[model samples]
Target: MPSTPEVNFFQEYWIDAWQRSILTLDVLRERGNAYVERSARTAPHVLSFAFEVVRDGRTLPRPVNYALVRIVPPQGTAIDSAKPPFVVVDPRAGHGPGIGGMKQESEVGVAVAAGHACYFIGFLSQPVPGQTIEDVCAAEAAFIEEVAGRHREAQGKPVIVANCQAGWQIMMMAAIRPDIVGPILLAGSPLSYWAGVRGRNPMRYLGGMLGGTWLTALAGDMGNGTFDGANLVANFESLNPANTYWEKPYQLYSKVDTEASRFLDFETWWGHPVLLNAGEMQWIADNLFVGNKLTSGEIRTSSGVRVDLRNIRSPIIVLCSWGDNITPPQQALGWITDLYGHEDEIVANGQTIVYTLHQTIGHLGIFVSGKIASREHAEFASCMEMIDLVPPGLYEAVIEEVNEGTERPDLVHGKYLMTLEARTLDNIRALGVNSDEDNQRFATVARVSEINQGLYRTIVQPAVQASASDRSAEMLREFHPNRLRFASFSDQNPLMGPVKGLAEQVRANRQPVSPDNPLLSLERAASAWISTCWEGYRQVRDAATEAIFLGTYGSPLLQSMVGLGTHHAPTERRVARDLIREADEAQLRIQLQQRFEVGGLPQAVLRALVYVRMVQRSVDERSFAMLQAIRDMQPLNDRMSLPELKACLKEQFLLLRLDEERAVRAIPRLLPESEAARRAGFEALLEMLGARGALPDEAARRLARVESLFGMNAQPAKVAHA
Candidate 1:
């Protein structure tokens, strides 16, 4: 005897629930089919571009599991051969290759659209029989050399984009062979592994908690000499249980029709895990992770050349996100503290390090998010020339959208302008969560790792090796939780056989809930509740893990047992030899003392500009681009290469640092003695400084000094819009 309204409501709820169930089934069926199809492909590189294999690592003397491919842009998007080639090296941390270019709006896509010859460094799913990380690094260097050779007409060296794990490898390569790399962009990569804040960045503590690199060795051996990547993917999923277990599925269910494609696309990469060799895995864990040797300048290749960050002379652009838990901004940027004493050390070493921190993008989003690719990646690619032209210093590159009413809107074709602001070591430290106690704990972990690794090698490894066989390893890999989940829902499962047919019927007679439907709202509420539960559990578990780690490792008795003292010592900064060489020092002093009065008008203008930049300690993309434009237009055009220009700028900077008053007064003498020439030079300098419409008080004052020195009329510093 229910009322008519109640009966109607019950009927609507039932219909809505039934339709949602049908759509969920259909989505699952599609996912299963995509998984099966992806599995069958075997050598699946999920890239959108048509590519040719340029360099096969297998052909090298020491074979590796990687290859270099040249991407052929689609018709009507002809590449400018004269433009520097762009090479992207995808990370092989856990997933298969090509995530960087799977979509139209991606790293590779942005580079190709900008008319650069594009290349990709991707690896096979299975590692070659005896490949090592060093072999892979060597193979990558060879690939870069080939690309550089092919692009001889380009203005500079080939630009490289290294994502995640690949970022560290690229840095190592640049350190070993600076001649092979131009401007390097490291996205979502961890350079300083031992760097992180307390209670956050739990992954950094896992190695110490687990008793160190022995566990990594055991896992590799358990995989039959090849480490399975599914475990790594599982670890990543575990970091965000709410999204992995609940929100992801609920999102697809809510918008099953529209979200299916994106879900499948991402899962295709996430589900398809790759493999790493035992040696490669162990090397990464021991040297890079546990030893923390790369930033310390202690990692040496098999050929005996020590890989040092200071050896990398190429300009580096580090793009990290504050929201990334896998590699937090601290881990991404803390190497500056470990490697350099101050910003002056960076300049003396002749390195340009530009970092951009996104407020909320996660680790994966740094490389795959379309919005990020369109804005950050596009701006970085467009500004490579200007970035190279920037003097050696630390900078933070800021990307902002162009205002329609802004000056020189025509020059702003990409809807965004990137500005480089000078930064100090204090700024880098602000981005980090560095504590001396944490460093000591990590150092203790490193020492413990060596002891445990030795014990395992002598006692456990032989037994493990004797018992482990290819068959058993294959069985272990097949039964992994990540793999089994996919397998269970795939065509291999008998219960899924009828899903395709039923899904087709559901699609044909599809019905969806209205946004205002009470049932739909309730479903969303339930889903959110479930997600919250998972998140709560994850937080508690992470807290327990962290507490246990600190309690066990923080104990003084354990530290004493490991021969570690509790005293915290500051990390020593190693300066490059070239920075302090006698020849360079003598030559710099000579240039500084040589009367600047003998230089030409162009030289004087450039010197004055550098002086202003040094004093203000800031330069933006608009200003840098205007300077380049001006340099190209006059008697300065084709007069000096970028290196020569950079050299001149550095010399002037050093001279200004030595004697500011003398440097400022010498500007007029460097300019033509003619009053008209001095006036024109002053006007041009003002135009460059005022390109963005307003100047800071320091810049305005500096300009006044220059006008007075040149005997020009005191005029307000302003310029017409381009």
Candidate 2:
């Protein structure tokens, strides 16, 4: 090892180098200003960029404009029919479709490279007058129906990818029409709205800090009908003052020559904020963001049917990132904890849920980063089959690297394979820095929201709505601070014409600073230091806000005044079964019998072995071995001669409630000469006799007589052990 002094000398040298690399405050400010000007100039072109068009073969009664953007292939070549279909639903929060697939290496592009048929769910620039969320959902359903029809010629259902605002919306559509969805993937979406850890997940604190969403209502009314998208973008930017003030600008200045185009492209979308109708924004705030009614199983369609997530039969894949302060993994995964409370509940409900958490990817990166797209999204698209094969359960998606020499796909999109590990909701809860006490704070927020909304409607909404008009709305959109930047940069300004010429000249001779340059290094150091300081300031401000809010409003007296005294019921105890093991064994047997009737011996045995492995310690490997042995029998080939054996196995599985089709399928797995076949048949017969749910004694005897043909004797030791 090197001597301590030598190591210290190197460290000291690097520190000095870093100090020398810092950029002057003036230089940083200038760099940031240039980026803003450039971005503003390019805003229109970026916002107006069109998604490559695609035609759906399955048409609807009314024309639902559909597009197919070849995000990776660049729009001319045909896609392979064998690849799975990936459909990206852009958030309708304010902006439209394509954000999820804006770049060539975006979510859609990643799926296309992985051999998936890519589809974009893009809407018209204008929303239909009086259109409700239900109408939008119906349109989505029609789109899914069309996609599914086209995919009937291929294999597997289409994977629907929903981002941010679209996540909950797509989930709502899936909850109502599960048959249309294969596996649902949600990114940067928060389903458990009221769920957050104290002093963290500040976005959740936004609703409370704003004193409720009446300002949103007022804005919508003032705009005549629509809520400006600039407000939404402003809210997002407000999360980090350092980024809004210095860091983002400094980053552009540090790499101005190379990064200007990229910065302009993103700013185009960022500046081209869209609008949402008054009723739409109101509904979202009341039912989702603040009300927290959707996940509570309280949200219902206008037609009266309840929207329960458990009603969705399709697999759900939740992708969240730790670095996404906007929608933390806690917010993304907390719904599972809130909804089911445990893994057993999920399994019992026959739902397969898989969640993957990226340690460092930010919110936008979950949908926009090519690296994330190639690895995380690609693995998910490639492994739908493997995931489907995973029997109904709750699992954490674990990614692992494979050797380059292995028989992996050539040019694998990702460097790793997606694997599933059984997980309980408690496991998810542990990842969150939340307590039940923290959730109590949300109850207070919700109560305050209701009162504020009521107060606004009663005291202020009438006047706000009465004075609004379409012209005013347009003017409002034009003058908004977020939009003003773009407007001021446009060709409409006389100064912009000169600035544009200068920008072009700068582009020609821009002597971009090198990453290795000492000055560039110093700029980065300074930016980091500033960001750290800003973060500390933000933390203290938030702490003080939270302290004040809790001190006065969190008290029982104020909680009562705010109508927040509706006591939370004590959490119910988990049911503890008497003879739990025996019951589980019996249940397993019946489930197997049902599967034997429906699928076959191989499937039935495989399922039983799964449960056997799950319930019994040290039995997993053995049960899996048995499953393989059963699969290798090729019982289908000798079904005619092994009818008796087949009947026996069928009966045993029926006792387990495995499904009738499985029993019939298993008929072929038991060969005439196999000794194990006879024993398997015998056990199946006993299961059938015991599983007759409501048969009379005489009827039971008759069934038992039929089962006796295969000897309904259980190995006494096995029954006792069970």
Candidate 3:
């Protein structure tokens, strides 16, 4: 009794359903083949761009697993030798390298498109024998030096882009060898390991739940001398089981025709795991993860040099996301709290730290999303020069898109304007959910870690090492769950042989269901329900884990056993030594006095301008660009280098902070005696301040000071026309 159209629709739906089943099986076979092929390759970098090796670590006395490669740009894009070279260091956490340049719209790609030479630091699957993290650091430093030597005519030091784990390693390099590196960009890196909110971040309590670094050592011992990276990969997957187990596969299955290439491309890198030496694994767990000593300036190298973050003089740009549970904004920005008590201390230490927060991007999205690459990474690359020119202080780098038909045009080639606004320590602290009770709990964990590590080394380490063997280690790595999952479905399995032939036949007579089909809609709804069920399970599991962790670690008896009192005390703040503080202040005071009356018209004008900016606490690309234009004009042209000009600006700023009244009064002494020169300087300062919009309150005060020093009346001159 059904109509003709209804009968035809049912027939088409059945045919489409049969085709989709066959297609899904084929896609799976192809994915298995790709995995097997990738696993068989040696030294697989997985970079979308072609590269040539520049330096090999195997040539060194204490060789590492890494190598430096120069990227070969595609057609229509050529490297400019005059621009600063960019070096991207991908995280070697659990996967092989090249995530930074895995796609066309990535960090390395953006840098290359901007006409800069690109380089990538990657490693092999196996680490060199007896190679420690310190050795790896040294190798990276040597590689950077080699890159610098090749580009002697470049404008500045090499700009380093480090992601996640590489972020902390690069910071350590910058602290030890600040002279070789330029501005460093840290994306999704957690410098402060113990920082997190109570209910939101469950990973922070992982160490406390396991009792200490003993479990890490036990895992390493079981692996015979190298830790299996598959285990680390499994731990990361456990954080988002819904995505790992349900949504990821279901999405691929629903759109198998379109999603095959993307899925395989990502899986190639995800499936290939690497290894870490036992010593390197143990050091990271003890010193950085459980011990929490890097920011506190307690970590030391083999050569007896203290690894203090204050030693790094390069400008640091921290890029994090609110949705990144792995490395939240608190973990990314909490190092400021650990190093300095107040914002003034950062300025006094001569550090320039700029941070930007993405609203809802996830951890991997921060580095791999093409949309993020074209916007945030593009804006960052365009503003590196201006970032270096900013005065020593804490700032928040704000990037906003340019609206259509707006008078305020894009400063760079992109549609975004990057602004650096001064911020205080309070602003940084507001990014975290800081609780005194939480701090004491983490401090208690640190003490327990020390005691446990000592006990393990004395009693447990010897027996484990004596029992471990190379054959058993290889067997353990081979049988890891992550590896077995891939191997189980690959072409090596005899059962998959018929799947390939059936998939080929389905592709030859393909029939895809219409997106609006009723059956297809029902299928998608069913998939969604499955995903939701997995998510609910994950939430319940996480809540129970957190409750258990707090109950076991927060016990009074356990606290006392670890030498912590029944009522735990907050950790003591670390401050700079008095001798260093006094010495730095003395040097700054001497420079301020010496340069108080130095220079002619140009120098006087710049000194006044810098003082105004210091008071207003706002600096952006538009203002700095205007300043550059003014610098290119007569009298200031070719007079001083950028370094010298930056030095002058810093001296004036320090002088203003030391004594504002005296510094403002001395402005006239540096200016020319002629009234015409004084008026012209005042007009230039006003122009720079009003470039963006209306003057802020501090800028108004500064404008009044400038007018008073020039002996102008209460009614200011018409500088807007100038």
TM-score of each: 0.93, 0.75, 0.93
Residue 265 lDDT, candidate 3, scale 0-100? 78
Cα lDDT tens digits, model 3, 1-722, are 76687667677778887776777766766666766776677687679998999999888877998999999998899787867789999998889888999999999999999888989999998888899988988999998999999988776789899999999999998888988998899999988988877677788888887778888888898888888888779878888888999888877777888988888778778887899998898899888887778888888889998888887877899999999988989889999888888888788878889999999999988988899899888888878867877778899998987776533464334678888989988997787755665656666777787788789889998999899999989888878888877776777888877887888888888878777777777878888898899888988888887788777766678768777665556565353454765598678777777766676666667767777666557777777767666666746455555556666677777777878777778877887788877777777777666666566566667767777877666558443321
Find the candidate with the highest lDDT and give its number: 1
Candidate 1 residue 350 Cα shift, in angstroms, is: 0.9
Runs in model 1 deviating more than 4 A are 1-3, 567-599, 635-643, 672-680, 708-722
Q: Whole-model Cα lDDT per candidate?
A: 0.82, 0.62, 0.81
lDDT of candidate 2 over 1-722, digit per residue (tens): 76686565555545434332232222323333543454344122222223454543124343333333333355564677855577888776655456776676677766766677777776544454566666667777877776777677555677889998888888888888887887889988888876666676777777777777777788878988887777888878877887887777666655554565676656655656656667777888878887777677777899897777776767789999989878888778777766676676665555778898899988878987778877777777767645644456678887767565533233233466455777777778788645545555666777787888889989998988888888888888878887676566455556544554455454454444334555546657878899999888888877877776566545777567766554754222122232543466568655554444354433333333232223221111112222223434546575322223323333442333344334333444432345476457545433322221233444444334333333334433122111
* Candidate 3: pairs in clash: none
Candidate 1 lowest-lDDT run of ten: 570-579
lDDT of 1 by residue, 1-722 (tens): 75786566667777666666676776666666666677677578788889999998989998988999999897889798767899999999989999889988999999999889999999888889898888888898999999999988787789999999999999988888988899999999998998877777888887887899998899888887989889889889989999998898888877877888888888888887888998888999998878888888788888898887887878999999889999999888888877788897787667899999999999999999999999999998878877887888899998888886676655554899788889999998886555656666777888889999999999999999889999999899888888777777776688878877877777887766567767667877898889989989988888898888778877778777788766546333242444434466567567668755556777788878877666566666667667767767766444666656666776677667667888778776677778787777778887777766665667667766766777775565453322
Worst 10 residues of 2 by lDDT: 616-625
